[model samples]
Target: MVFIRATQSSSDIACIAVAPLSIQPFGVEPTDFDAFWTQQKQTLAQIPINPRLTLLNTLPSGAKVFLLELDNIDNRKVYAYLSVPAGTGPFPAVISLPAFGDAPVQPEPLIMTDFAERCNSINLYISAHNAPPNLPDPNAYKPDDLSKKDGFYARTMIMAGIRAIDYLSTRPDFNGSLGVSGMSQGGGWTIQLAGLDKRISAAMPINPAFCEQDGWRFERASGFPNYVLVGRNLNVDSNKTLTNMRYYDAVHFMKRYRGALMFQVGYEDDVTPAATQLAAYNKYRGNSTLLTMRERGHTYPFDEYFLGRYAFFEQHLIGFKNPFNFKAKFLADAGNDRTVKDTAVLEPQFLVNNEKNKVSNIQWAKIEGTGNVGFQTENGKTVARFSQKGKYLLRVSADFDYKLADPSVASYYTLTDFVTLDVGESSNIDVCDSDKEAPNFSNCPQNIALTTMGTSALANWTPPTVADNCGTPSVSSNFLPSQSFPIGATKVIYRATDSKQNTAECSFSVIVTKGDSSTPPSKNDLAISLTSVVTTPRPHSFTTFKVKINNKSARTFTDIKIQIPFPSGIVTGGAATSTLGEWKEWCSNNDQCFTWLIPQLLKNDEAIL
Candidate 1:
């Protein structure tokens, strides 16, 4: 298996440049490449997008972040971190994709940033796979059919990105100024999406992948997924790979991309070869800027490129304001996943990233782990102790403080990441202990009815009673008493998180319906809103749904009943737990439905079913 290798220097690579060409692909594009993608787009248009959004957290800059799920190809769904900026109106948007693994591997790129608030844009962050956010995923990066071009994962991945753009364009809050960005595989997608969708006004791809995929044919190192030699069988002869890898290569898609593009090239990048990235850059015939960072490698472009990824859109007049006045860098290290012996005491060393100069605080959170586990600081070093033997995922996050370029914008931002480890057997010392319970809001507020003649009304309600097992849990709400609620139904979500990062949430709605102040309302004036429900998407999986009922009148009602008919072909499952009423399941001539009956509906009070 060993053979003599011929060493080549930078000059050797420089001399092997291809013939003079612009808007050229790494290899010949399939004759039906354009037609095939057009047909895919047509198919995507027919599928309905069932969107479900659940509020996760809120940034100090008044941005509401949520986990958004949308149905995609083959009954699959795409999950993303959706950030809605403060103060409503149409706003420009940016969709940031991910590289290699399902989610962001490192702490910095694990979640999202404050670009939505600082730049006043709607931001959507997606992983390489359609997995949930903030959790360790082992099912990611599964094998795909590489024998055929159309059967490859690249087709669906690119189409999913296009569908993301389609979702943004249809949003009433989107101002139509759209941009796509990513590093590595995500970078490759950034270019491909821009090429496929005309809605993309700009793109920022950092050390992009899938570039010059056929460079191996010329005895050169290609980008990621480089199929140079199949294992040890060097004698196996094969020159064709599903249309010469033309249909799925980003270099081929570059010829069709005509937009404002600013891509970065890291001279030290080995994952995605620098030569292939340069070759793709040369082939793009449209307006593009290549920012070379000699010190960086395969990483997020925010640090390596000029200013940051968001700054490029601002510089190019893409409708976003630059929020950078100085450079803010954080290098979080949770160490790598490694197997530990019997004791399982000397866990992965979690180091603070750039703490001396810019960081204001350092924190650790346990994302997920089996058995019992806790993290403690020993001799100024972060360590984890497990009570049982198993593999676990951990995270170390640092608060980086920096001055924003815009004085009016937020002064700082936040980003998170992860680390993993495997333990043989625990020593059973069990020194470090953490609170495992979340604060409860047993007396959660009831939905209220507010009558307003104007566009908005000052709605008032009592704060929910919170009880915590471990000290006092920090509680926050998206809506406060006497806060202005727009004319319509609005959900008031309150969250309580403990010191151990355990959290609980309870939400109710405020229904504001316009009515004549002089006229008395009718017998029934109610507004009902349903909270988002998340399911496994697997067939026959158990699911749960929460529905809130608000009485939008001053008059009390008695003997009220609500009926919900189940969709056709959905086999009924036992479900019923009422907070203020009784639920009855009845079938009328083969059709199934649920009926809830309330003896008394109090004025301005809400019922849950």
Candidate 2:
């Protein structure tokens, strides 16, 4: 049923709306953004985890520190300081990133060994650069071709961080859980590593750098490594450099993350500004906490606020809890009020502040007016059936159970939220009364225009992920990927429908155009390839054709149309399945003839099917 919270007197109840702060993103991301990073990780995976560790020293708290090195992408090396607890135990791991431009040898007393000892976990304090600590070389990354995406220095640093995580996971003493943290440049790395790598279940990025690198487009201050002046060093085209830097922008990454994030931003800090980091926090749908220290600027918070990070990690990584105050709250939201028929389907959510803590069980009870109310779990949701048509108040409670290191210590919390349901006589609107919210669609593809290779271009895109408060939503699309889009503009609509029949839709346009052949395709503009495979049998033979179209022209091509003859074996007048183009048969000199329509494709997209 729809949840309606009971209210008090008119004088007591007040509603206020405040506009949220957001850092609007600018610039362009490559069409192959996700694919590019996936390829980089794959490249890293191909290289072996040639790890070497040397004992450095041991703290009084029985924490041993060691110097570690590992092989990264392209046979490059990554250096770090590894710290572990004294026990012969398998512990959760954390890979700490370093500050920008300054590669110090010691990652210790700062946050490495201290964190390991406090949480009793393994700590791999790593450097962002290829060279070892204490040796700060500006040219460690060979930042000459910084104007290009693939050749950017930030990409290399991220790859090195990936290698560090790879090395830590291989240790026998390392537990399955892993995390990342950093300050300034390292803070930016922390967010990037956590967002880029799913292995990191928890992250603490403090005054992070490299976020919203292009915020200067609107004359606004950006996070660390502000690319405004950095662009001059590029000494290249400003537009091209802006496009290239988008790949390294931290804001783009956090938008897709949903894990536990311990993010901090400074109010007065000139680098990694408060607005930028808060913008990142707002974009992420996760268990996250943002601490905006008033006087803090590009540095660690005071001991009181700083110590909370350790407690946060302890609760998340080590399953230990002193206080469950890490900015997030244990919540049990019963949702809005509803008037339904006899059966009421309720989808109550149970969320915990720390990952280590578990939601043991959820109990639904009728606290007020009710007549023989029965409860049952259907498809993982609580359903209530009332015998009589009356108003009933329900309290759905969830327990946040903590797993303690010491069994003797007691740790647990219960959170409950209320919802009211009105039961009417049996009717067809049973599902409607229970659900009133529509599914939300995210990651919807941006509108794209494509240059037609033949009659049509095979346009493909990753479907958007949906979220609904009710239940698992089923998605439908107007266009099937198997079919081809003909010339001109085609709107691809994707719809998501929940179990209750509530629906939502999102769409993007695919425009196709024929280009002018008079002006030859630039060297970096177009790439088109075609391949055919055939099979012959005693009775019949079949040929399969595949064509790939890529548009990196940075501008649309218009004017000329090109078409390859449709395959001949199919039944005429029926349908000849071509994944890449439309089949329009014409009455020509022969039995039949067909030509594919060409259209203008987008600047940076490619299509295979």
Winning model by lDDT: 2
True-structure lDDT of candidate 1: 0.65
Question: What's every prediction's RMSD, in angstroms?
Answer: 25.0, 23.5
- Cα-based lDDT at residue 422, candidate 1: 79
* Residue 514, model 1, lDDT: 72
What are the per-residue Cα lDDT tens digits for candidate 1 across 1-609? 011222321122112222211213346677898898898888888887778888877777888887878877756667788888888757888888877775443323323456666788888887556577566567564434455555566777787887777788788988898888888888888878877898888888888988877776766667886644431133323454635466777876776776777767765566887677776765554444445544445664344344666456775435576677633333334455688743333322222223342443344544466755554442224556677777776554444434334333222332233456677878765433445767788778888776654566666667887756544689998989867777799999999987778889989998877756565445467877665355444686655666778887785444567887767866664766776669877645544777788665557788888
* Total colliding residue pairs, candidate 2: 26
lDDT of each residue in 482-599, candidate 2, tens digit only: 3567789999999999877889998999887765556677767877776655434344554445456677876654332444454476533434443333545553454444444334
Against the unseen true structure, what C-alpha lDDT does each candidate score? 0.65, 0.66
Superposition error at 533 for model 2 (Å): 85
Error of 1 at 24 (Å): 6.9
